[model samples]
Target: MDPDRPLIPAELNRYARPDVLIEKGRLRFLELNISTRLGGDAVARWLADAYIGLCPESGLRRPPSTVAARCEALNRMRHAGNGHGGTGRLLIPIHSVIDVSGARQRRDRIQPVIVAGAQRLGFEVFQADLADLSLDAAGRLLVSDVPLDVVLLRWYGSDRIIDDGGGLAALCAADRAGTVGLFPRPESALVSSKAVLSWLREDCDAGVLGPADRALVRDHIPWTVCLGLDGDPEVERNLLRMAAAERDQLVAKPAVGQSSNEVIFGNQMSAQYWQSAVADAARESPLVLQRRVESGRITMPFRDRESGQRVTTRVPFVLSLFMVDRAAAGVLARHMTPDLPDGDVVIGMRHGARPNAVLLAPAS
Candidate 1:
């Protein structure tokens, strides 16, 4: 993709799944995952259902299902494009060779739920390894002899698409030739990168954004800067100095990572270790350093395994909000308990955080 060319405004409207932490009674966005590969929706639906079943008098409604919303979004995109009319086939291309950390295992567990949801939505859904895709005479993507109308990318690392050779070529050709609709177009991953936050901050500083956009950045986005020295040297030097001096107020994250993998809290690291980590991360890949917002704690009920009784405990939690086609879909909340060994400043399922159902209160 051309760095100079701006993304089409329509493509930017696909999805915005932002992970947020509540600090001082305000929601602060930690990072944005703009692709269709957002997981935990199935689990969230299950939890919401179970909660409603156990407490029918709560007077709260279950949050909308992300899977159902995603299926509907895909169907709309297909119809808007050149999709085959009745019961078009949707193929979820899995990457067998490249796995992003524990993505393959999570995808394996989540795929069945997604497929079941898609099937219920009236689409003949199928999953296949990327290597299994083929192109017909019209550049249409096919799995075995069946042509596809839509492709859902379940894989995490978009950069690895180039490594798949023919599968990548055929898929790209099909998408570009309008033979098949690709949800959350591949370029959507670029908008998801943590580096984009840095760019937004830069744009705001340069007065490139309008008043409303600038206010949105100032109100929601934390102070963020890319770790590497790819841009202005003086700005890079100032960032380096600030990182070294304000270690307690910052966090370092990989620009294109998920599940809080390799996220380092500056307060948790010694000055020497923090410097070394920043240097190492800068050398490896694009990294972002952002001002840390301490996550607020909430009291929730949980069963005590050893005592065989229910108890309430305070835990740090993050709320993930999903917006499809610029409309609010639902929210999924995950909290980390103090007793968990893997509990840290970062909250994610991979780090032992447990999903909590978020229900909407009845209107007054």
Candidate 2:
């Protein structure tokens, strides 16, 4: 389903990489990243050898790299609307001053890995902040004096991208002149909305999906609804009824948001607090309430270098799939404390948690 409007206004639409949840042998579609920028390639590169060595007996294999596909996607976008293509000089833009929120603070941690991976895949890669990006007199996008053929934008979200007016203007100018490419065409942001899950559920309920599709939807898609946005009395009444009735079974999320910011799991709060949260969510951004599903745990090996010992622990984790050029590229496993079943590994990384590259093997 198309969003009412694009998250960031633009001319083209492409792919959206979504975050999904699996519980009790079922898949649950979660929110999406319009930018679709996961530092997976970098992480996989960092962990590839170590993981393979550690799991040699398990027949662990390297997950496919996304560098080539991403480069090609940008190249395709560069030539799609305008007949312009060349040896891709890709520039990845990151925030110079890290946000106070402490999410994706510096590309320094991930940029070098991406650079190495991209270089291996045969692309000229550069990293810069908005301050260093500009449009030259001839309308070419330049990063620190070097003209960029494609930009692998990691500005975080579409909202953040829109707020970078000067940089966005320069980028847009370059795009208009067919001098540069954007990995994700801005219109693709439309697919990132959690609202789409509701539409999918509606279609499922309406019997629009055939048996195979209906089974997939029923097994994977949670019951999600956009509440209090329209201010219709009947809609609001029904929302409150369902929300109150299933307080412990619900999870509330911002309709258009990222980084798991301000997500409220109903089971964790009091009835009074949940009501207030639902009210406040409606007042700010339209909110979606989905049935919460508990995630299972996985056994992971952790080695203590100082002690020169290895131990295995069962940790709660969420598996994320990375896609490039519309194909499965790799898998990422984020471990979290068992207490916080829905905890975000990215957020946990700030405090200290390591992300793992998942090697998928057939069932024995």
Candidate 3:
């Protein structure tokens, strides 16, 4: 590690996945996934397994595939005990509240796939919402009466987990007693906020980084300023003024947000709307005004669900790079239209920009 680099919280070391974009021979990092509740671990493993099974030859080139690597990491954690007995029983904590019907569907389809993988690796797996779990007076965490060894968090965010007094208190008690293990170690959420990224951006300009580190931050992170919180009020005020004047060159993002919620793009809206959004964003919640990077548009073929034929369409794509313990793990390529920045995957499965499995070609 470079001494000049910004000090990443010790908690983020457990899992440091960064969302990055590779364009024009430059790698731009958007944000870090420090929270353990992050999704897509299951998806990444599933995709890798499916791809390797479909084309065994590719596996020969990319040795010790992503899934294999992840399993090794999990097994290591299980064996470490980390104050708990290495019983090899892992619990995946989900959101306590959800539409019962949708939750059932996820239990039936989404979770079983990941459970199967865990079981194959010599581990007992249990899935339950956080509410279903209990920490007894003895500080033993249990799910349906079974003692848990480690927690593979699947909940989306930490705010809910931390706010659930019973759950939060139990987890903290167990953590202090060293009775159970949490993959992300809980403190990772502190750095997960976009506000931390803004601070990092400031560090770049302050010459806190070495020459090479400075170049990386300058080339990757967008110029960002945290608003509605700590920082030079004058600087933030100037940034807001500039955003209003040059509406097409900037975007305002929530400092603590997820899944593209309340992301206001200046280029796509009217001046009045953009200005209004900036004001509301700054006032409602801490926000970061980021210089917008135009996405790269490319054409790719997909098998149309209805037509049952391959169709080629042009869309803006983002390369989502996954990292585990600071090591590269997987890459997911997602594409969307200019109008829909984050893609429309949730509204309609086939309608939104979707990710495709990476296929490797034979070496020349």
Candidate 4:
């Protein structure tokens, strides 16, 4: 993908799944993960199976299957606007370089789960590194001489594509010529920035959002401001003032980041450190200062790994809603046990959080 190329109009409208935290009985969106390289689909399936086995008589509805929903999403994308009606070959390109953070190892573990699920649905699938993909003379994406209809991106970061000598150019050429489709679209890289969320809140504050849009923003989106040398002067001034008086209620996040890496919680910092950190981040690149939403706590049972004894404890949890083709597909819940040393400020796999099933209760 060319960094200077303007995105097509259709690319601007694509949506991604939202990672949400429940606070005060409302869903507060932490980030819009606009890429298809999302985690937890396989974990969701495993958790659902374990949950159903443990609560056979509970009468709660089984959670929708993320694997099935994602496979269906791929089928739809393969056929959408391409005029190819039959089953199409899908490829999951692995990155050539693996970072020390273990992201590649995690993706490698889950790729087979998705491939198996897609195979059961009668679609042909292939997995290979980005270097394995090449464009044929006709500009079609191919691996081992087999043409591919869609590329399911499971790798992290678009910068990897740019780092490849010719892979980025080939993919862009194939995508532009309509010989292949890229799920989630490359424009997702642009939309996934945390700055976009700040922009949404800023637009609402500026009265640019319509009545319904304003209500939606007010209800779900947290108060966020992009902090940088080029940022809105009024917004930056107000954010700094609030940070001074109520640092405990704020968090600073990189405008483009994954996991909890480099996330700074205001409450955990001294007043001097907080001020210096904010100033340093603004000088380097645009970062977002958002009102932090604390995760809701729930009591759930867990079996002790060493003793095999079931124990119940309170834990902090976050709910992630998966949206496929603009429709709600399923929900995934991740929680951290009370014993973790990180306390409740951050919760993720890196922080010892575990995936839990979300079972829907029967309506009265």
- Strongest candidate by lDDT: 1
Candidate 4 C-alpha error for residue 230, in Å: 2.5
Worst 10 residues of 1 by lDDT: 101-110
Report the alpha-carbon TM-score of model 4 versus the true structure. 0.86
Cα lDDT tens digits, model 3, 107-131, are: 2223454566678898898766666
Instruction: Give the alpha carbon lDDT tens digit for every residue of 201-311 in model 1.
Output: 999999999999999998888889897747676777688778989999999999888778899988887999998888788879878999998888898878887887888
Highest TM-score: give the candidate number: 1
Instruction: Compute each candidate's TM-score over C-alphas.
Output: 0.87, 0.77, 0.77, 0.86
**Model 4 C-alpha lDDT per residue in residues 1-364, reported as the tens digit of each score:** 5455678765543446688988878989988876453434666767777877888887776566556677877777766745344448888776544454534332344456678877876779888666667888888887888888888765436333323546656777887777887766766667678888888997999999999999999999999878883866887778777787788888998888777667898989899899888878777887888888887788888888878889998788887787656667678788997567645466777878887778887777
Provide the overall lDDT of each model, using Cα atoms, as 2-decimal numbers: 0.77, 0.66, 0.64, 0.74
* Model 2: per-residue Cα lDDT over 90-185, one tens digit each: 777765443536543444445455677567656787766666678878888888787777777664343333234377678777877767766666
Ten-residue stretch with the least lDDT total in model 4? 100-109
lDDT at 96, model 3: 40
lDDT comparing candidate 3 with the true structure:
0.64
Question: In model 4, where do residues sit more than 4 Å from their true spots?
Answer: 2-15, 35-39, 81-87, 98-110, 156-165, 232-238, 302-311, 341-344
